[model samples]
Target chain A: MHQKRRKRADERRAEILAAAESVFAERGYRAGSLAAIAEAVGISKQTLLHHFPTKEHLLVAVLERRDLHNLGIVADMGLTIEAMARLVDLNLDWRGLVHSYTVLSAESVAEDHPAHEFFTTRYDRSRHALADSLRAQHGDRLPGGLTPDQAAPLIIAVNDGLQLQWLLNSRDVAIGELFRAFLATVVKGEPPAST
Target chain B: MHQKRRKRADERRAEILAAAESVFAERGYRAGSLAAIAEAVGISKQTLLHHFPTKEHLLVAVLERRDLHNLGIVADMGLTIEAMARLVDLNLDWRGLVHSYTVLSAESVAEDHPAHEFFTTRYDRSRHALADSLRAQHGDRLPGGLTPDQAAPLIIAVNDGLQLQWLLNSRDVAIGELFRAFLATVVKGEPPAST
Candidate 1:
């Protein structure tokens, strides 16, 4: 009975996170409220507070729950250009995750914003990790002669920039393909013969 | 007396827009408040309402006020790879425009967000214009081989994606230099020789 009760709590928490994700994505952390998120989950504000305690806590939880599958792939595969292409392909199916991540990350750029530190550290770490991975695999310089440190941020920028485009206009763009095209030139192989 | 009053009103409206830009950049449109913006400019909500009349009107005023110098450059130079490089150089000095644009464009991706149509049209026109420019200059295929429409969005993605990085940490990266490095491969020339 205790195990079943614990599972129920976990399920409720997951549902709350989903509600919070959409709320934060649509309204943003500062404007999105507990009352609205609670109402979405069909619960009272008191019960929602019992689960999250505060708005900041809920914001943190929603951010932490972002699908880290692509990052994990980067870690495992060592960020080979092809690996990035494959990873982007996966993001196509995860629209909710993409919208929330893109919206929240941009909103987090302001100083003192709830996720500001998280994003600052996250970008720092991602850049460092990518540079390290490229250096480890390609040895200090990528195929095109740029150093790992220099190339790392460009790669990150492309990923993020493409997300905004794809989020706004999914019907026309093939982000994975576009990313692959960008990566080919950076990674120092023959540019693809055709689009 | 009428002339003096007209000039003062224009100045006051510009001030309100600047305050609104920072407020929206920090808290986002839905979350950002008129009262805070009014207070920042040392006025009451009633006075602000008199000037703009509604929150959406204020949002429109702020969005419209964003510097379009970059787009203007693109138009004059016909999307040549070099024109983009020069364009990015200008954005580095326009940090206020950069922050508000980066934040709000991402937020506008949500369904029915007020600026959603604006961004959608902007990207569509930019991509079309770029493609037309590239095709006219290069004759159906860029030196690197991708058509202009194909490369247009990628260029945009890098510009935006790099803004996030720079907005977060301007200390380390030179977005213009990084952009040039990416453009080298896409535009099909020798990559920069050194970091």
Candidate 2:
């Protein structure tokens, strides 16, 4: 009975998070409400509270879910040149998701924000994982004499920086092309190809 | 007499924005209030509203002031290797200002945000100015084979991206060192030296 209840609770939490993501993505964090998220999940406010306790908590849960989703995509692709391609492809594939999360993540930097710790850890892990993969792929042959830690952040930074540009002018700047250029420059030890 | 009144009004507006910057920096956007800002400026709420109209308008004004400040800094430096170095220096010199603006800028990405247009234009102007400077420096050399337009966003992206990382872990990374390395790589048309 306890196991069945646990399974049911986990399922409900997942459902609520999915609903919250939709609401937050559509309405943004400030405008998104717990009541609306509950309604979207077909749950009473009390039930939503049982799962998330507060709007900040719900926001954190939604962000965590997205982070896990991103990590899964990165992990499944495995560490290869193809993995780099896949990373770019995945970001483009989920442009809305990427855009929404980027905006929300930026907002999450406020002191006392529930998602602050989550974002910090997520950044650390993502950077480390990508760096590890790159190290594994090229080993001693990696150009630019970059350690995994330094190179990892550079890759992450490029991804984020390019995303902002893409958001502002999507037609002119292709996120994938930028990412590809970044990868080529790092791997080949060349300046990015002139536009 | 009319000129005196206009100058007085501009001075009062500047005072309010200065106070707003402090309040927002200390308490963040969500917790910051017009009342708090008024108190900080030693003015009544009515007097504050006379100048700012609303808390959101005040926030927008603060952002506009910051954007203008950064633009002025970039412009004063002129476009050359010195300008790039000055950009790095200004970021370090005004680290607090940079942090405050970055945190607020991230929050202002909401679709209907009053500051959205301001940020968009600020970004465009900053990028274009940097690109123009870079073009002048190269004088048709096109070292990386990339146009200034293509390379300018990349440069901005690295700076912004690195800022986020530095904010997350200032102890782990030296912002100035990273930026200097980045500028060296871009300006010298070579990869970063292995260190």
Candidate 3:
């Protein structure tokens, strides 16, 4: 019975987090309210508070949930240009999640924002990981006269900047195709001078 | 004197807009309040409202003020990579404006955000202008087998992505230098295959 209750509690937490993501996506991190999230979860604010003691905690959890999903994808398929492009394809199914990500990342730029550390660490780890993967896949010498280190940030930048553009008009921007094209330019083997 | 009063009013409007930029920078577009902006301007909310009717109108004015500054720069110096790198250097002095711009641009991705249309129009105009400038500067072929039209958005993406990263840790990321490096890769002339 104790194990059964623990499992039920875990399921309930997932339900609340899903609701929180939708609320945060629509209303934005700062503008979104815990009360609304509770309402969405069909629970009292106190019950919601039991799971997430503070709004900041809940915000962190929401970001962690996204990180977990991304980590699983990268881990299962290794970090390839194709994997990153596939991430963009996955992003289309959940525009709200993408919206929250863009908003929170920008919001998190402020030193005092709750999610500030979350994004700072995220960028650092992601860039480092991508750089490692690029080096591993292509050996030390990469294409376009750029090292894996230099190319990593540019690829990450395009990945993010494309989302902002895609959000505005998905019809105009083919996120996956454009990303594939971007990859093509840089992955054409080392430049003539480098060679 | 009516002329003197109008001049004072104009000065006050400028002060309020500057204050708004600072507040919005620190607190973000949606979370920052009109009351806070009025406080920063050393005036009552009523007086603030008298100048700009609503918070949305003030947002428009703030964005317009930024555009005018950017326009002056681009116009004074053509849309060369040097000019853009200079713009990045200029951003260092006004971290607040850069912060607000990043946050608002991300926020504006949401369709109903007050700044949504403003950003949408800005990207379209900026991209078009950039593409035209590139074509005029370089004939049909661009460096990486891309048309000027294709390169335009990529450059803009780098510009924006760099800002987001720079905001997190300005010391580590030399925004201007990084952008200049990106320009070098893209301006190296058409790929070997393209020829």
Candidate 4:
């Protein structure tokens, strides 16, 4: 019975996270209210609070849920085109997660935004992680003559920017195909001489 | 006397656009109310309505104001690295404009958002314009061997994506430098063998 209760609690927590993600994705972090999230989950605000004490706590959980999926994709990831391709496919498969992440991260640009610290830290870590991976193999320059430091964030930017475009208009843009072609230019091609 | 009246009217319009862009940047389109924008502009909601008529009208004006600046940069743009570098520099100078555009454009991913059609049509045209420019220079395949159609939106994605990263954390990322480096790989370097 203790095990059963624990399992039920975990399931309830997940339901709240899903509701929170949808609300945040559509209304953004600041505008996405706890009340609206409770209503979406069909729970009272008190019960929702009982599950996650603060909105920031809930936001972190939502971000972590997505990151957990991404961890699976990028765990021990190489700078290979194939590894990055899987990450692209993962994003394509999870539109809700991508939408929430893109909206929250972009909105977090404002200095005082709640997610600002979260995003700044995350981008820093991810850029370093990608840079470390690139450095391990390429030393100073990738095929395009950019240092791992310069190339790492730009690669992340391409991924972030592509999602916004796809989110804005999925009709004309193809995220996966475009990402693959871009990786082709960056990861291979003859190393250019210019800065 | 008539000329003075006309000049003040234009100034008021510009003021409203600036205030509206700030509000929209912070709160997003759906959540950004006309009253808040009026409050920022030190006017009444009625006066704001008188100027824009409706929220959609205001959004179009804000987007167009940004587009006008962009048009000056890309009016006779070629697929050269130099022409694109100027645009990267242009965005770096316009932080407020870039923030608002990134926020609004990302939020407009929802089909029912006010700026949906506006962004869709604009991206469609921009993608085509970039593709046309690239095609003119490369015939069918770019220096990186991807067709203009395939490469065009990715260039846009990189620009859009880079802005969000810079917006999130200006400490580490350099938009202009990264963009020029990426452009170097795409516009020059040897024609790559792969897609």
lDDT of 3 at B72: 91
What's the CA RMSD for each of the models? 2.3, 3.4, 3.9, 4.0
Chain A TM per candidate, in order of listing: 0.92, 0.78, 0.93, 0.92
Candidate 1: CAPRI quality band = medium
TM-score of chain A of 4: 0.92
**All candidates in order of TM-score, best leading:** 3, 4, 1, 2
Mind giving the per-residue lDDT tens digits that candidate 3 earns over B1-195? 999999999999999999999898888888899999999989999999999999999999998988889879988998997888888888889888899999989888877888888898888888789889889988664665566766777788878888898898787666676666667667543222210
DockQ per model, Cα: 0.70, 0.44, 0.46, 0.47
**lDDT values for all models:** 0.82, 0.70, 0.82, 0.81
Best by DockQ: 1
A1-195 per-residue lDDT for model 3 (tens digits): 999999998998999899988888777888989999999989999999998899999999999999889889888888987778788889889888898888889999989998998899889888889889899988664666566776777788877888887787677666776666667666543221210
Tens-digit lDDT track of model 4 for B65-171: 98987787666665466778888887787888888888888777767778888988888888898889888987877776677887778788889888888887776
lDDT of 1 by residue, B48-161 (tens): 999999988888777766636555776787668888898788878878778889988988898789889888878777778877777787777566656677778888888999
By DockQ rank, best first, the candidates go: 1, 4, 3, 2
Q: Candidate 4 lDDT, tens digit per residue, A134-181? A: 888788777766777877877888888778778777766778877777
What lDDT, from 0 to 1, does candidate 1 have?
Answer: 0.82
Q: Is candidate 2 or candidate 3 better by DockQ?
A: 3
Candidate 4: the clashing residue pairs are A161-B161
Q: Residue A7 error for model 2, in Å?
A: 7.0
Question: Per lDDT, what order, best first?
Answer: 3, 1, 4, 2
